[model samples]
Target: MSTVEASAAASPQTGLRVRVQKLGTALSNMVMPNIGAFIAWGLITALFIKAGWLQGIFPALRDPDGWVAKLGGWGAYDGAGIVGPMITYLLPILIGYTGGRMIHGNRGAVVGAIATIGVVTGADVPMFMGAMIMGPLGGWAMKKLDALWDGKIRPGFEMLVDNFSAGILGMILAIFGFFGIGPIVSSFTRAAGNAVDFLVNNDLLPLTSILIEPAKVLFLNNAINHGVLTPLGTTQALETGKSILFLLEANPGPGLGILLAYMAFGRGIARASAPGAAIIQFFGGIHEIYFPYVLMKPKLIIAAILGGMTGVFVNVLFGSGLRAPAAPGSIIAVYAQTASGSFLGVTLSVFGAAAVSFAVAALLLKTDRATDEPDLAAATAEMEAMKGKKSSVASALVGAGRGGTISTIVFACDAGMGSSAMGASVLRRKIQKAGFGDVTVTNSAISNLSDTYDLVVSHRDLTARARQKTPSAAHVSVEDFMGSPRYDEIVEQLKQANADSTPAPAAPATEDAPVGDADVLPVSAIVLNGTGSTAAQAIDEAGALLVAAGAVEPSYVGAMHEREGSVSTYMGNGLAIPHGTNEAKTAIRRTGISFVRYPQPIDWNGKPAEFVVGIAGAGNDHMALLTRIAHVFLDKDRVAQLRAATTAEEIQAVLNAGE
Candidate 1:
């Protein structure tokens, strides 16, 4: 759900695009984890090559001395240097092992590395493409082969069988890779290399920004940079000591320019927030900070594209390039990776791109006086819609206030391995520092949440599911795992509660309270016997009640569909809560709830929903109502009672009984 996009849900080519995005994500996953190795190799190459900085700094290194030539790897010495062996064997095997591990764990990793060595020795050039193929292929094959004899293997012989089977399969794959895959991948790499050559030779490389800039805003920057460009650029760097391709997607200039323009010419929240966003974008090398700005005014994309072109053109004119990929695309990283004699060109490229983008963005913002200043929160929601995940830093732009203290907190995500882990770590530090060390903060997959925590934090898109998993826990929805203003709010809430002589356990009510301590769901908003054929229709039926209650605009209904398309709002236990995408908060006039009980279960994306609760919460106000709904749904007896209830008052009693 976090990986699926709202805009993508509406696109006719959603399947193809999602598949492509998945492929890109997979490829980046293979490379991003091993970036440190790439950087190490790049540093070695930059300093030890024939015309490298080491030789320029220490002239004796340039001589054909045995040790010098052997270490430098460019002279007549016949020995392998640190640079060549690392690029040729170490990096490929590491990548192969990582890809395998991603699929089948340690066993897959071992087999993948074994198979990759065959391609590494078989090919004249680096075997990155071959490693990408063989690693996953080996893992998949092992998984299938294991499945064949899974239960049949004798208990005593299980280890022996697994070890032998893995070794034998790895041997076969290695042989196959040597004889079959090496030449095919080599030829393909060559063809791709030729295409890059053609573009660089014809001065057409800069034109790639037309695709790059737009794709970046869509959150495909990692795929384009690490998956496609980095490998190609590494190959070029091997031959020429640097590659211009590294700068294509990693350039921060365009994003920085847009932020600077917002700082100078933008209005309202965007203007107030631009300076900090600019700092993060330009210096921190987080290009995502500016994406919301672009989403707010799509015309800014034209500026980004043109700015990217300008940077690329300048780099091309000066034949400027980096020795390696700049991981964060920060100006400092870019400068650190700049090739020898390219300082001027690299500086010019960044400044040139910024200047062009700033100029264009300024003109657009100045001329667009008829429209009111954009809502940073709406733009952030739009950004999340396209990105298919919450952008944590972007959430700070909203500056939303918070309340409540919590003793137990759980950071929940789909897998609970990546983002949730990070969020837990971040919040743990804050809690310890706040002297609330006794407070417990942990992370778990939404599915693995067997026990109730006092507070549950999750992505806004996944809040419904989190509530379903732990109905008693107060839920806080956030966009990012790395950083969120909500963390500070939580800390402050605890401090205030302690000041008021309230224990941490007594703060759930404060955290759960909306604007006022009253019921948000009234009898009028509850509708029984709703009729809808599909999930969209069910969502519409539910959303219409909120509209009629003056809770939201009619446009909010469409957003509910879009939100459903991106991530199923299906909470388990025959309940479906249809809510607008976070960006659709602008459509809400006030907090309201609508409950529609379907006589027959509605097909909600493959899940059957007997009850659809449409929600339009204006702030943290909606969270309290959701917590109440979660509690009722968690009780099988109460759920059964509500299903059989004939009167609206009966349903209300079931929901609001204990609360």
Candidate 2:
């Protein structure tokens, strides 16, 4: 289970925290994709602005008549430069388009851009906050309005109706954005900028490290930096030419100090791993490389807090700040974005933070050496658990991989009722087909896991928790339970292991099992050259096919969207299996599956999906044919044929060919 999942099971407050984190994740998603644009603007500011590098190198460039001054948007040239317009117009529009695309699709993106322009024109300040609001609003409003006339539009008039409806909605949203949202967000932005200035003026800004250091260890660094700090910092930078807000979470010193301390005072695997980790943490700017070291000695968080405070204090004393956010917290990135005269201050801040954290961490490590020694493996596991995904750098610290003969394999998930059950059914069939009768496969919730199993397979997000439960078992993590490539790897490993031993008898062949009132998937349900304007539209098409086959009610289609809203159904390898949520089981009239192959991939939650499989399973009735379909997809050559197929019959034949 993930930290969010575990927390929700514990208390309501933690559940609320999870919801807040989700919101942060959503906000971060909007900004992360646009970081490149921010970088471009920063580069321009550092190189061409009035107080920039070129002016320092050649003083004449600072004059109003100089070409450099004209390019820099300074002196008599005013706001004519690319730097001002890019941040004011280009960046926010990109963010708005991305946000709208996330909410709906291409149409939503177009409407979102239109609405964002209104806010841009209305607000004096850069309207980043306004774009974040209006973009999604435009997409959502368009979606709701379209639903009213869905299926009610006549055939040939579809294009006419869609174009006019979208144009009208965009115009209305744009007007609302200009008059209402622009001013509201502008006020919010100014207030936030004022708060940061107050913190800086009072010399109390370093205190923020107390919350920041702890949050970074918990894997909320990206959220805090990109979602909250970047937007606020951008506004501050516009007014003052630099912003200290960007350095708070992006400082690499605190993490570097902890790793250096581990190298000097730590023992065993942690000591051996610390040197390489230090390089990655400091130079590569992957701050996560040192999180396990802190997790091993949680008191080291104090070291981090103190180090952060020291760095902030040094920067404040020097009145130094970055022109833009230095992503990945790398020293190289930090230097790249530093203001023209702030090099000394930035350098000292890193060294000071490193010195403080290293001293504190060394003291903790040396004193605790006798009594604790700190279990590196256990701490690494805890770090991965907190991160909600495996950390390759942390894994290297423990040297965790081991090889042995496997007899029993277990599949685990949070509830073990949905994903785990399906995964277990699929893997069991593979093992049986391989004639490995001695190998026993089962499914269980992570809470019920036992250490007795020889192997445990789980989703990557849940693997850390499963490891805690079954520490002795060799673990394999996968993303998709339906058709993971890992399952095939496991089969291959098992086959190789028994190469020198007596061969087990092959299982007898049986006719493919029946599913629902008809076959698992019928020919008429398979659509070649499948058309969908968006992910949601694609899902609706698949659901419509299922409904046509009498396998599910229309309500099941809505349930599929509900499920997607909570957790995306995107499986890897260009395939996405759209299914109703567990609660929507009643919507299933009988077991059924529908296949739609898109010649051109549609964006399924930012991932390209060429194949969409809509599934409505009634009990275990569909597992057999589902397994066969999964295997067909597992084969790259078969998938290639399906992708190239011209007719629905060709696609159907390719799917059944594996059987």
Candidate 3:
């Protein structure tokens, strides 16, 4: 039987293994993201707050009742203590994106959104602003803002930028903060929070409460203590509550609900989380324990409500002494004396409520793992980031584009025929919208895409081709044909690289090695798409020309084909260089430099190619010509530039950047 079938056949309690595996994977993904040490940062900050530590750092947010306490909360939490957390808010976005990838493949928007909510509200609201309200809204926007490359260049640039922006720069920020920048950053955060509060307190009271309250409770409350305030940790905290179960430390409503419900669905393993939550609330006074269990399945909102109503009923029926509102966490927080039937009565009420929640969860839900997809962590992070902000995957991809490297693109779906084409079109449109200038976007099957695009975006099973064919191109998978923010991000990267790649003026042409007739040779450039030809054949045709010209040396001609098979040195863009370097000097000489059209296409790199120019240079300083040649094919005006040049002189003129 298949692994999944066996999983189904095993007792529900058997899920403990899966749960442990998943938790391990989740923990691994949380910390081992393109982002740095995210899970460790989260757990650190969690310990800080759970321990009620850091009172020495900010005296105002400290617990007033216990002035000397060194653990738990800053001296002046809430609005006054809101500084350090907000700037790091993007971390939770990363977590949500990663988690979504973990659970649902590319269909991560919804849970990513929910995860965002969990992070934003897992804090002390009175001290911090609520950020969770943005989660669902962000998810909605991501769904609608889908963008694809669609054979366009601009979208690729955007994809490179948006997705990679934080990962690349966030590291820099982390370094800066580690080197004492964060301590000073508080001034800015304080000012920003004050401004937000001023606007809300004076003009939009109710609306502000709705927006800021939950976020403060979930995210910023003791964020610094919880480590979510760190650049990487905050990114994790933003998308998922690595520590929201805090208030639940005192409140039984939401905490007990998920625990009992788990017993119904995956009974045996559920106890791992459920019992842990119960014990923490009973004596540990830690509230964050319940968050992981509840946030595991967002549909647990029903359990939360059921637990809340039951807690309220038992409180009234037993006339339990309202002991400090029980930390809004569990009946365990209540004393045995002033309550209904003492501590025993409270446990009964708690179990009674738990039973109801378990029944609802077991009879109504089915548990399954998320789909398999590439870059799951990054996807989940972006999806989570989109939850509470105006950002979308498309926009974020565009934003991260500036840092991306050149990547080939492939559009893949079921037959490599229709959906691929559709995706290419959407991607192109989004790229145009992002304002990237003149980017190339196209579509072809994985079988035929041997050298065309660098990154393959597809939904189809190209496993055979992926393993057997070229592996340089990174494979990206998506479910819908609508769009991907990543394509635009790549376009942005291309733009930056182009802007940065102004070729240095031709290396003083070496007198040691000379073009026989700088004035007489005819130079031609050929451009081809969706065609394939073998490297060996192209070289053979070129060798025939050199042989006909009597210009080719035997040693030079033999080494050409040998090196071609080793690396295929034909970096495309309507160009191919198949030259073996001199033992000392690496100048390409045997250009057999004419364009050859192949009747049958062959894999060039990983995509299809129809036109190619073989390059084989000899001598020490012949590199100037090669450099010029590389630049020629990189631009979009390849055909026009080549056509205008009737002779070598004209070609050289066009090759020089317009003076």
Candidate 4:
């Protein structure tokens, strides 16, 4: 059980580290369940397209045009239609829940949700694993995370909920191949073919036009039946428009072998919605998805960029005029009314997409191949392997930790106090060996010990005289000498005492605090600190602090757009809480506190909000900081105290001691 006796943590500095480890475990858990769904996602389609004919069980399946086989005119895929949703929406719940329960006991649910986000996001829509599962899982995880630490936990389900909106876009994209966006596009295709039917009956438009369409299918669809939406022998063999059906029948634009290649292979997202990019590019029409990747990893994206251009260029050269929409609004669709070479135009379109994508992917995809890192095809397999081992190990460790006195513990030193801090780190390792999961152990000079720390344990020099006056109520003293026999006995005794305690205060029933808190603290504390030589710099310092504390990765500041390239987090009212992401997994982390007074006010946004507050946290922790800080931001007295904090110590006293 977890409990917070008071707001007795030593300082925010120690809390950050524990958060990182917890989230890492969460990442491991989520990846497991999606492994199976992803592999099967690809396989489900294969049975219909790859099989020579409809087998015994598949023959009973419905078709894409008929949801029930009886609703013949409907545009949805009847047979394998639900298969896609099942893969994306339902599988993660089952896998995450089962995996969670089996591994971390109460916390397993939370861990499952944490890891599931990554797993589902790792795959395209077909193996998506909805936020219905992801949201609940994240909430459940946060709850468990709180249970592991003190009662001060935060709820963070909104991220996953927001993530689910993409599913709507995914469904629309899937249907584009079959529906043609309404009857208007269909009429357009027919109008052009009407006179041609006349020519065909009269012996004018060559039967070779049939070859032209097939050629377009080959190139424009950028059909990598090899990767996504492949042929299931069942659907393909059944001749039921449902198998290999998406390949030729479902038209997302006139087939930009270029866009298709990127949809199937390109893997860079400037931000939200990488999987949806395919639909936007292929049908909605934006080829920028290819560019983000090209920019992020030039060597990697080059081949695919060239491949896309090649496929598009070739299609235009061929005169393949698809009456349907072409992404980035290709020449095929634009030229549908243009004249004689429509057949050639269609051929060129297909070839263009295929050539560009293939070339670009081949050139950019520089895997040692021998390293056997299943970049695309075997990605799920690697995840499956993690499910079988690393997840189990991490969970077992976390479970044991939960069963002990500290479910979430932190290790700290100066700078959190480096040497004794190093000692705390060593003890942290021993505790880990004993199977403590998310315990936080930190090291900081005795002066800054008030705002965080459920209980404080320190070596010789870090005594009661130096620390007790600062903050942290629960202090356990030990000698600085690590090798001394007495210190060992004292540690063992504490371990036993903790193990022996009768009904240690049960974790408060209220559960983990929310991840996002827009309101909490009655007053705000602003700090200026970072590596940049200029005191005037105004990036998201809290986010940077979180990264340094091991609470979050450095990528979080960028992900949050807190550091929108040169933009300072100083909201300008002399206030800012730049934040970061713990997107990876749930773990306890130290919250670093510092006070900085710039010699001159830098140009933050035009608002002039510069009394900055920066925060770093797991995916769900920002709200707590936000809410607490917001209250502070509202206080004029607190702002004066923050402005007066000359030394880090003075800042600590004013911000934490008074609060």
Tens digits of per-residue lDDT for model 1 on 139-239?
88888888999899877999999999999999999999898998888888788889988998999999999999998887777667766688788788888
Q: For model 2, which pairs clash?
A: none
Per-residue lDDT over 588-619 for candidate 2, one digit per residue giving the tens place of the 0 to 100 score:
89888898888788866545789988988787
Q: Which of the two candidates, 1 or 3, achieves a greater TM-score against the reference?
A: 1
Off by over 4 Å in 3: 1-48, 55-530, 533-558, 565-575, 580-592, 596-611, 616-659
Q: Per-residue lDDT for 1-659 in model 4, tens only?
A: 11111111321322332233234344434444454553344344333332212332465543544334322222343434544454444555455555555544545544544445454544333222232234334444444444553533356764453345333323332243123322332343245335433643464433322332332222222222211122121122123222211223222332334334444544432222334544554544333323333323335334443443443344434423222112223333333322233445545544554565555554444442433222221121122121212122112211221124533333322223223333454454444444343454555545455635544554323433334443333334343212223234424534663675443332222222432221212112334433332212444454454555455556654543422222223332455434432232333244432234454554332224335444543333333333334334445787676666565545444444322
lDDT of 2 at 609: 83
lDDT by residue (169-217, candidate 3, tens digit) is: 3333234333333334334445644553464345432232232222322
- Two-way TM-score contest, 1 vs 2, winner: 2
Native-referenced Cα lDDT, model 3: 0.40
Query: Roughly what TM-score does model 4 have, to 2 decimal places?
Result: 0.26
Q: What is the lDDT of residue 235 in candidate 4?
A: 21
lDDT by candidate, in order shown: 0.77, 0.79, 0.40, 0.37
Give the backbone clash total of model 1.
1
Q: Of the pair 2 and 4, which is ahead by lDDT? A: 2
Model 3 CA lDDT for position 544: 47
Error of 3 at 307 (Å): 46
- What is candidate 2's TM-score against the reference? 0.68
